[model samples]
Target: MSWVPVAVSLGFAGLTVLACCSFKVFLGVRRFGRELERTKRRLGPKHAALRDELHDLPEPRAARSPGDGVPSV
Candidate 1:
């Protein structure tokens, strides 16, 4: 039928568009992964320093009693 060629052409065009979109998405994901790795590397030392500082802090005190020279509502 005459419509068969038109159908085949449309199918090919659709596939081409889909493939291009897929490639673009793949590249974007790869770039994002690289940026994430770079950021992690840059902040690794700062993160470790903050973690160490947190550990060096003193422990919390026990809860105070309301009757310790204070009024108990």
Candidate 2:
């Protein structure tokens, strides 16, 4: 019946909405962290294999030529 009561109710509603959204964001972050950990665990072995394979590959050497700077058309 008073403006004061209406303002208080509106403020409470806003706070409730904010609290709900914050909770949702927290859940989302937690889920993302868990999924990230799972993905890393799944890829760990393959990642190591790739690293070992890469290590055994030939190393790159800079190409040097007697006339390297000169273009031969």
Candidate 3:
């Protein structure tokens, strides 16, 4: 019936809620990290190959042209 007990109960309730929320957030972060690692591993070689192919393509003539009305100098 006293204010002290009421305040203590409210504080305990707030702490319990915070603990549960923190635990859920921790689990979500762990799961996301694992998924990101998996995705990076799966894409690594494919991305490298694509980058190589892109590099092998011939350069565009327009991109190399100078003073051709394309804001060159």
lDDT of 2 by residue, 1-73 (tens): 6999999999999999999999999999999999999999999999999999999999987889778687867
The deviation in Å at residue 4 for candidate 3 is 0.5
Model 2 worst lDDT window (10 residues): 64-73
The digit string of per-residue lDDT tens for model 3 on 1-73 reads 5999999999999999999999999999999999999999999999999999999999876565455566734
- Report the CA-based lDDT of candidate 1 relative to the real structure: 0.96
Error of 3 at 56 (Å): 0.7
Among all windows of ten consecutive residues in candidate 1, which has the lowest summed lDDT?
Answer: 64-73
Candidate 3 ranges with C-alpha deviation above 4 Å = 63-73
Arranged by TM-score, best first: 1, 2, 3
Candidate 3 deviation (Cα RMSD): 4.3
Candidate number with greatest TM-score: 1
